[model samples]
Target chain A: MKLKVYTDRMSQPSRAVIIFCKVNGIQFDEILISLAKRQQLAPEFKDINPLGKVPAIVDGRLKLFESHAILIYLSSAFPSVADHWYPNDLSKRAKIHSVLDWHHTNLRPGAAGYVLNSVLAPSLGLPLDPQAASKADKLLTKSLSTLETFWLKGNAKFLLGSNQPSIADLSLVCELTQLQLLDEKDRVRLLSPHKKVEQWIENTRKATMPHFDEVHEILFKAKQRFEKQREMGTVPKPGFQSKM
Target chain B: MKLKVYTDRMSQPSRAVIIFCKVNGIQFDEILISLAKRQQLAPEFKDINPLGKVPAIVDGRLKLFESHAILIYLSSAFPSVADHWYPNDLSKRAKIHSVLDWHHTNLRPGAAGYVLNSVLAPSLGLPLDPQAASKADKLLTKSLSTLETFWLKGNAKFLLGSNQPSIADLSLVCELTQLQLLDEKDRVRLLSPHKKVEQWIENTRKATMPHFDEVHEILFKAKQRFEKQREMGTVPKPGFQSKM
Candidate 1:
């Protein structure tokens, strides 16, 4: 039996998982768990991930959740994946681990929180709170500044100054693509100060070509829908906020 | 030079790192960066961790931060450290990874947030907000419920139903220790329903022994300070809440 991945492209980490498999030529069946409809809250998906969140995988009897962990497992379990994704060298791998762990608290929350509040909130069952959006926006900008001045210093193409993109690169870049859902003006305001960060995002996207684009296509489509809603001045129905 | 660990005992993850080193007999010099004093944000400390958080390690030339990443690196670097700490088996390690990753967004925030807002806020800088405390309290209960119903099911000694405590167990148990700062009533409210969670905390503590008790002494002392302040109707001075 092939590896099975349960995900939703509309989610950033889910896109990372699918793109990882495609990039590594790993065979896996993609199982969609629709977040928009709250299908992930169903009993069936909960069995795979007791937390009922996306980007879970089943390899034989082993069921795993958490995209960073899934990405780590894939890099190790699949012998064909290049070492650059998660190197065997002790110090190098530690640096990558540092980046991955850092992402959870810093990048993931900032990017996801900003998008959820400002753009994706309505469709995803949340009220449009400018206060909340502003808070998340500040975090997003701070995170970008850290990446530009600290992590992506000098001419480094990826985090930790590695030329070969690691899982950290893939996961983080996919996270930034959520900015595509933000209005162009908001996006520019958030990203304009970080030239190095901008370059790194493009580098990561370019490194993981067609597959990266393929997985993000759904997000692109949703962006269109969001734009139409904004132009039409329609509001998403109230209640049912995903506190997840 | 021995491994150098930069930490403050008051922080949850920092204690975990110190305890892990003590348990594994990984000799290290402890450098305390007082969070209460706002020393972590200083330029010197920022050189070690740009994110400016504690539980960072410098093993020779390699500098690593993020407690989870540091734990992962230590387990892998020290051959004497038993495999049970991290495990070489792919699936077992993956399951542990799941718990660790899940922790950052769930248990850490729930536990840390509750302690911060309800108890530690005044001394730490920010004025207490019952509303934010209520929000964090909700997440604390929900996360505890998940642990009780899902992760701690059956007669398991640790998460993933393992007898041996892994890095995830250490990281999470340390997180729970912050609840010690809560008043007796609040602590009971948060943890009483989860009998298994309480037991698991004991199991993790017992498994690690002297080190665990030794490291937690500082938090215990701080707890005393908090109690004294409460009895006197005094408040922690304002002007320095750690956003970290």
Candidate 2:
């Protein structure tokens, strides 16, 4: 049996897994667990990941969740994958692990919280917590600054100065891509200050290419839907009840 | 030159790294960065880890942060250490990675949040957000349930059924060990119902042995300090400002 991946592109991690599999030409079956529809909360999905989050995989007898771990596992399990994705060199691998471990508490939360508060919550009919959104924006800005000053210090296009994009780049770039869902003003305000980050995002996009574009289609569609809703004056009320 | 570890045992991750080094007999210089003194915020420490987090390492030319990444680096860097700590087998390694990855969003936050909110905040003379504490407790309980029902199934002595404690076990067991700072009533409430989890904690402690007890001395001291304060009827006032 082929490896099975459970995901929903709306999730940044899920898109990261999808792109990793596609770019590496790893054989896998993709199963959607839509968060917008609350499909992830289902019993069957919970069996695969008790936490009910996405980007989980089943390869042979090994069942795994967490995109970073899955990325590492896939790279190792399929030796055919280019080593640049997750290098075997001890220091380089540890650096990648450092980037990933730092990501959860740093970039992921910063970017995700900002996007969710500024864009997704409003579209999903949830009250936009202004205080929370501001805090998230601060975190997002700080994270971008760190990315520019620390990780992208040299002329390297990817994180950790890697010439080729690693899973860290994929995971992080996918996270920032959620900014596309925000309005032009909010997006620009949140992202425009960091020229290096913008360049890095484009670099990551170019490296990943058509697969990156393909995996992110759901986000594109969501942006369109939100825009259409705004034009139609169909603004969702605060406390409007629908599962996110 | 020996590996230099910058840590403060008050931090859970710091203790994990300290214990891992002690148990595995990895040589290192221990530099204390007291979170209680805001020493992590110092310029020199920031040079080591811009994020200003504890449990960073300087080994040869490699500079790494985040305890999980540091643990991986140490295990790989010191090949003489036991293999069961981080097996070379593909599936076993992936399973360990899975547990580590799952840990960040689930167990670490839950246990850490509960300790911080219910115990640390009050002890530090900060307001205990009851609502946040309750939510964290729920997450902690749910995490323990998942650990018992899923990860700890069978007669396994450690996570992933390994007879020897993996780095994942060490990292997780250290996170929960923070519960020691809580009052006996609160600690019992948070831990008593989960029998398997309690056993797993004991199992992990036994596997890690004297090092575990030795590394945890600071937490025990903090508990004693709190108890002393309680006995003197000199509880610190809410909104009291002190570094932590």
Candidate 3:
């Protein structure tokens, strides 16, 4: 039986997993658990993942959630993929794990929270909490600064200072891509200070290519819808409030 | 040079790393970074870890932070250690990673937040936010329920249904151990409902043994100090407030 991946492109982790499987040529059925409809909370989805979250996978008897865990499992379960994605050297692998672990508390919150508060929340008819947005902005700025000064400091193109992109790059860059939902001015203001980060995003995009664009099409459409609604001075009907 | 581990037993992750090293007999020098003194923000330690978090390790050229990262690095770096601590099987390893990844957003917040708000805040001269404490309590209760229903449902000694304990067991049990700082009545009220979690905690303690007790001595002392202060109607001076 082929692997089953339940995902929604609206989620950064979901996009990351989808792109990963596509890039690696992993055969899997893509089951859409629409975040816009809050379908992840459905009982059927809950059976697949008791946490009621998306980007879950079912392979034979193993059922897994948590995108990072699924990514690790995929890398190990399918040996056909290149080693650089999840290296064999103990230290390199540890470094990647470190980056992934750090991403959850560090990069993820800032990136995800900023987009959600500044753009998604308003677009979704949720009360726009300025305090929360500003707090998220501060965290996002600090995280971007750290990305430049620490993770992406060296000559390498990727987070681990590696020549090739790793899952960390995929996970993080997908998070930053959510910034596209913001107006150009807001997006530039939040992201322009970090030149290295901008370049790294481009680099990751180049490496991932058509698959990146393909998986991100949903976000692009959402961005357009949000922009159109803003221009008309109208609020879009609330979509699923993603618990990113 | 032996591996240099910077830790404070007051922190759960720090204690986890210390106990892991001691039990595995991994040669290392323990350098105490007092969280109370804000020593993690020091320039000297910042050089070693830009994040400046406890439970960081400096092993030759590699400087790694994040306790879970450290645990994975150690298990792989040292071949003499038992494999069950971090197994080699693909599915088993993925299961452990799932727990660890799930831990950051789920268990850690509830476990760590509850302790910090209900106990650590008052002890550290910070105003106790009753509202925040209540919110954390709810989250903690929900997490404990999930632990019982999902992770510990099977008749197994530890998480992952292994006869021997894994790092997931250690990391989680350590997080819950923070509850000891609470008053006796509150601790029992919070813990009594989850018999499986309690058993798992005991199992983890037994598996890890004297090292667990040795590393946890600081928490025990702090609990005693708080109880004594309560009895005498005196407030203890604020110690360190950990951000974790």
Candidate 4:
């Protein structure tokens, strides 16, 4: 009954969970479930997470899904490392939770959905619906602007007001890294236009995930596979048309 | 120097904070900010929450916004009660957090948004667009089905696996109460269609807010006022069709 994590390395959520375990010294087992191969839909993993989503965990008798929830659980279980990552100071912790909550509803959906549908899917040889991609791009831009203005502006190294990395930075970095698989143009847009964010991302890479190259490479390969699938007409392009 | 919550009693988020405090026995002074009067936009209040959203709290010198964030903060601050509401159990708590997180993105936006635009605004003599209302209705229905199949099937009383109430129930109950502001027929549709959910709602109301009569009356009055406004041509009907 060892602590086990079920994940695909390329998924942003899975990457965040891996980093959380690494930073906190949580030694467990890894069960790789490849989404590209539709391994998540397998019956065995379905019992652990009925929704069939990844980055789920089995810690002894405990089984949990959702990366943010898993992060909170790990922090509480391992309080020795919680001060820097989760923070006991109520306000600081609240700030992190606030950002995480908003990120799930706003940034995560917009960034991942838009990039996948518009840039990545098109590159995969699927039909590219420019309008949908543009709408998603706008949402991502708005989310980034809000993050910059409200949370990340004066912070030194992390998204939270911390010199050391927090779970907020971990989650965000994983997501931003996943975005690189979309298109080179989006990569530049995310990294260049927001200079502070770009620098902060590099900071996170050094502090938390020095071996991020491997993860990025996996995601890059995923992009190539998606493109091949589209070229083979295995998947239909997203239906997106301007209503206006 | 004491805990202070800036809220409008009429707001859904504010009610969440208030209910959280009430359930957990965390006493705090409340600073009522009338949203209808645009009091939250006042520069002084904006200093506390730049988002200008109510249910913002100040504990000592630390200020925080977002109702779910505030709930997490309180749980961290008062660890003695964490097991009771937030729960330290990894898998159980993850289930609760997932439900709460999903509620914000799905239920709160569509269900509560519809109440505000269709019923409340119209009661205030503001125009209500049939198209927007239809979209909200569909979104809410879809959300309710998810809740039924995924969340509330075997719970009996509370959300998670808990026999007693928890933060999961608090977050969801507050959102569910927003539906009461809808027209009577809509309320029935929102409530009666789901048996377990309806029972859970009733149990929560009995356990937490006993005098549902008063709250229901206030909501009814608000809806009436909105309808009067609509009749008086004070606000235009929803101009854009919802894409939900």
Clashes of each: 0, 0, 1, 16
User: lDDT for model 2, on a 0 to 1 scale?
Assistant: 0.84
Docking verdict class for candidate 4: medium
C-alpha lDDT of residue B34 in model 4? 83
Every model's DockQ: 0.78, 0.74, 0.83, 0.53
lDDT (tens digit, per residue) of candidate 3 on A1-244? 9999999999999999999999998999999998778889999899899888989999999999999999989988987778988988888888999889888887888878777776787555577655566767788889899899899968889987799988888988998999888776678877898998999999998998889999999999988988888678664233312222
Superposed on the true chain A, the predicted chain A of model 4 yields a TM-score of 0.85
- Give interface RMSD for all predictions: 0.8, 1.1, 0.7, 2.0
**Candidate 4 per-residue lDDT over residues B1-244, each given as its tens digit:** 6689998878876776776776567878889888788888999998898877788998887788888888878886864554767766666767787777678667877787677666666444567666657767778887877777777757557776567877777778777777755555557766677877788877777767643434345555766765566568764433323332
Score each candidate by Cα lDDT. 0.86, 0.84, 0.86, 0.73
**Local lDDT at A129 for model 2:** 63
lDDT of 4 by residue, A1-244 (tens): 6689999996898988887787678887889998777788999888888767889998777778888888877887765565778777667778888888878767887788776766556444567567656767777888777767777758577785578877888887788777755545445655577877777878888887555655556777876775566468654433322231
Instruction: Please report the interface RMSD of model 1 to 1 decimal.
Output: 0.8
- Chain B alone, candidate 1, TM-score of 0.94
User: In model 4, where do residues sit more than 4 Å from their true spots?
Assistant: A79-82, A120-132, A223-244, B23-25, B78-83, B88-91, B113-139, B153-155, B210-217, B224-244
Candidates arranged by DockQ, highest first: 3, 1, 2, 4
By DockQ thresholds, what CAPRI class is model 2?
Answer: medium
DockQ of 4: 0.53
Would you list the clashing residue pairs of candidate 1? Answer: none
Question: Proportion of native contacts found in each model?
Answer: 0.84, 0.78, 0.89, 0.58
Q: lDDT: which is higher, 2 or 4? A: 2
Per-residue alpha-carbon lDDT of candidate 1 for residues A138-229, written as tens digits (9 for 90 to 100): 78888898888887867878888888899999999999999888766667777888888888988988999989898999988987887777
Q: Candidate 2: which pairs clash? A: none
